[model samples]
Target: MQIDAHQHYWDPARGDYGWLTPDLAALYRRFGPADLAPLRERAGIARTVVVQAAPTVDETRYLLGLARDDDSIAGVVGWVPLLDREAPALIAELARDAKFKGVRPMLQDLPDDDWIANPALAPAIEALIAHELAFDALVFARHIDALQSFASRYPSLRIVVDHGAKPPIVEGPAGWQPWADRIAKLARLPHVHCKLSGLATEAAPRWTEATLRPYVDHLLASFGPDRLMWGSDWPVLNLNGDYLLWHSIATTLLDVLTDAQRDAIFGGNAAAFYRLEV
Candidate 1:
């Protein structure tokens, strides 16, 4: 089963997406399963792991409600106020729904870079492991060290670094060292995985496959095919490129690997990592 492991569905009218502003003209609108269905069909994608766009619990429930009715949506990576005292209860409640596959803390947007490494969030982390849910880390290169520390602290937690830590591809090969080194260190943990998504948006607007090859190659080297999964990143993807373009580029980049290895990166890894029903 070919799975787009990370994607999103959002309605701006609901007024919860603080980052989805009018400035990002192309994506400042509602995007749901209907809009993505045809693209998925074209890409031979059987299912998708719809991730949360807004940080509110209301939005998480909204995505879960959508997943309940849509078979195309295999699971959802929602958000909870992890810092709150009631986080464990909220996580338990969300986990009651089979489609609630994981949680993403939006670490990149938070002011504290060390937030994930904080000891206070232990209860919430433990709750996720106890419930058998994964953790989708929405971070950047800056948070890799903290992420590594957190992953080490909770060895049982199944964590996937969303968008390969949103690498600095736009900065070109010259700026690749520390980010590459940091990612390699993070990948040393067996519990940590990564998604091959959102790189186009991080590259130049007219980015070619060559512009992204080095970063993609580094991720493959660091995490290996078994630890990597492909994601469309969708509407946010529209800011730089479309679903088909990103899909085609990713496919070409993985052509060097054997069919089984490519299959793992395309779908198997995501299914195993997210614990998706498909």
Candidate 2:
């Protein structure tokens, strides 16, 4: 049961996607299950975790609604206002749905790197722990220190670092510093996991397998296969490369691992991390 750990389905008209503007013509329109169906089929992907593209409860609910009808969707990682006083109730409400697996706070867009570690978010964080829902940290290299502190503070909340903390692939080897070092520090936490996705879009426009190999090697060495998982980051991934191309590249990059290790990164780890039924 292969699972694409992270992906998204959104409509630009939804008004909640503040980041989706017309200038980014490649991904300014609507993208739904039907559009991903053929690609998933071709990649032999049986399930996917559709993550939140917008930071609204309405958009979360919209994705949940879509999940209700799409069996191919293994889980939905939606957004919730963690700082709001009413967040715990809202999280509890969302937790009622079997497909609502987790929440992402969109930390990457926030100005403060330490925003996620704020004490005021305790209530919502407690709710997530109580409900056994995961926390998807959509962060960059700069946020790793705060993320590490937060993970240490909680210790029990399941957290997955999206995009391997989104290393600066465009800068080549010169970009390796802080990101690689910080990611290694964060990986020391057993409860923390990471997604091997979004690197293609992070690289130069004409990225190749060789261009991304170093970062991939670092992640594999830091987290190992059991704590790492594969994700497409599709639709958004279309900006730099297609689903098949990324899949092919990931396949080639991970080909050196044993079959069991390869299987864990491609599917087993995500299933266990997300607690998916499959």
Candidate 3:
């Protein structure tokens, strides 16, 4: 069963996505199972993990509600006020739903790059560990060092670095080395996982298989297929390419690997990390 492990659905009228503004024309409209159905079908992605696009519990609940009705959504990586004193209680409340797989705090949008390292948020991380839910680190390279320390502090927390820590793809070869080095360090933590997603959007109009190959190569070598997973990051991915195109590019990158390795990166690893029933 193929899984596109990190995609999102949103409506503009909700007013929760402070980032989903009119400037992002490609993603300014509503996207739902209907919008994604054709893409997933074309890509042969049987299931998906609907991740949060807004940093609101209302949006999280909206995604979870969709997951409850839509079998195509295997689970959801929703959001919570991770630093709030009530975070553990909120996590416990969300955990009651079988489809609630994890939490992401929109770290990339935060003003403080070291926000994840705040001691006040320790209870929320512990709650995720206790509940067997994952932590999707929506971080950029600027947050890598703190992320490494944070991941080390909670050795048992199932943390997955979204978008290979969203490397500086626009900077080309000069950008790949530092992010790759940090990825290697993060991979050393047995509990940490990496996602081969969002690179297309990062590369934008100039994206090509060649432009992304080196980064893909680094991730494959550093995490190996066993510790990595594939995600479409759709809707937002429309900013650069579509789901089928990303799938084709990913396939081309993984063509060198053995079938089992490809299988793990594309589906098995995500299933294991999210503990999806499929």
Could you say which candidate leads in lDDT? 2
Over all chains combined, what TM-score does candidate 1 have?
A: 0.98
Looking at model 2, report the run of 10 residues with the lowest lDDT sum: 109-118
| Per-model TM-score on C-alpha atoms | 0.98, 0.99, 0.98
Residue 234 in candidate 2, Cα distance off native in Å: 0.5
lDDT of 2 by residue, 156-191 (tens): 899999999999999988889899999999999999
Model 2 whole-model lDDT (C-alpha atoms): 0.95
For model 3, the superposed segments whose C-alpha errors exceed 4 Å read none
Q: How far off is residue 80 in model 3, in Å?
A: 0.6
In model 2, which runs have C-alpha deviations exceeding 4 angstroms? none
Clashing pairs in 1: none
Candidate 3 per-residue lDDT over residues 55-168, each given as its tens digit? 899999999999989999999999999888999999999999999999998899999999888999899999999999999999988788999999989998899999989988
Please give the TM-score that candidate 2 achieves against the real structure: 0.99
